[model samples]
Target: MKIVNVVKPAIRILPMISKDEFPRMSIEDVQNNYFWGELINNQEGMYNFRKIGMNAPKDSLVLFQFDNIIIASAELLDIEKFVIPKDGKYYGAYRFDINSVKIFEPITLAEINKIDSNITAFSQVKQEINSLFMVEIQDLIKSKQMPILPDELPRQYYGKRTEGAKRQIVVNAYERNYKARQACIEHYGCRCVVCGFDFAKFYGPEFEGKIHVHHVKPLSEINESYEVDPINDLRPVCPNCHLALHSKIDGKVYDIDELKSKIKRLINN
Candidate 1:
């Protein structure tokens, strides 16, 4: 059952700490904390790195999953980056509207696979929900009448598999984000930062503003999705320079300065 094509906001599947794994807090306890808006205040939402992606912003729907089951839903109210002193590590935390939280009947991954097989893995699902899919999930949650028994669940309930599809999704999202690219070009100009290749000077006015915005921080290194700073994180480069930038030597991708120096040395020789 599909709902009206309303509520087109981004949706994400957030994995929660399972009681079987931690033995400290059960999903029910977490649900109670979330319902009372105490999760963030208590720092229970903090993770080693960002869990939700940049695409998921305020008002985005979140499906809280424990083990393989979608146990609850909430609307993201805000997200913040915090540093933990005990570990001296940066962590991402989320704050969701307690009033919007709905602890629902557990929807297993096997059941969700019937709805959309594209969700092959929990890690693969990430923040890749489309409008139609979002509506379908919204309907699924609304249709559920009761919450699952948190105490009666078995340990090691589900299996996990990793797929390369997530990498492709992140690559596409990083490269195709228009606002980030535009802001990068606006800050750095249309010339290639590595070789100073100007599209307009080479191909005339029609080709003006044509440049590939390269992500300075490789997507492979980013363990989790976090906010990206356009000016600091992106650079305009020609196709050739972009390829050169990606070329690995001794397992190291060349930075702008390293690539530029190599180009200068080659040209002078």
Candidate 2:
């Protein structure tokens, strides 16, 4: 299969909570709070709130709801956990980490109930919850803050690969490589293994357009014809770095580490 670039966009809502309301609350505590409110959208109308919770093993997803409406949500990975600033300019004195927020179309109670039931079933099996936390619309109105709008929410790019393609790649890599790629990305802070670009601007569609996951040891070079392992073989790299690393002569793969070192030298020079 030809190597292709992929970019996926995700949505998250960040709530600027009041420090006075949650002076010493940890992330767990905040997630456990059943705060709910409406998230309005100019294009899609009002989305009702539902449930709010976290995703575990890694508690990286924090969510809040209105009824079935997801008013606020955020990914915990990139967040810098800290206390609210001393200044009281913001509505909620407390602040949680957030990349971007977005308002989707209003969700129905039936949908909320379905999600709740699903969560309950999954919880029985110790599965992670990925739903909203329903809050009273009256409370939100009383607070005098306009309903959270989808346009006001932040935007996240999931990746460029289609769901099926991503699944295949992830599964294939895991079976063959055994989590090496994940470890490397985590170790490198998810930055390009060679270029060391960490700017958020390089994120979203634009970044996805230029970056790709590469197989360090080309599958052809592996002695065994077994399935590919994602963790071991896959590494995120910019297009230029990937090409340089893959440039070869006489069927011999170029030295990836050497290429990286040369690129670093050139950058420094």
Question: Can you write out model 2's per-residue Cα lDDT over 27-65, one digit (the tens) per residue?
Answer: 322322322211211211122211232223222343344
| Model 1 agreement with the true structure over 1-269: per-residue lDDT tens digits | 88776545677787755643336765554544343224433443333333333446668888877766788787877777665433444355566664456666787777676677777667534545554577788888888735222111111111121111122210122212445656778999999998888999998996888787777766556645555677877788888888778778899878889999998999999
Off by over 4 Å in 1: 1-8, 19-25, 33-55, 83-90, 124-127, 147-269
TM-score of 1: 0.42
Q: How does candidate 2 fare on TM-score?
A: 0.28
lDDT of 2 at 139: 29
- Model 1: worst 10 consecutive residues (lDDT sum): 150-159
- Whole-model lDDT values for every prediction: 0.61, 0.37
Structure candidate 1, residue pairs in collision: none
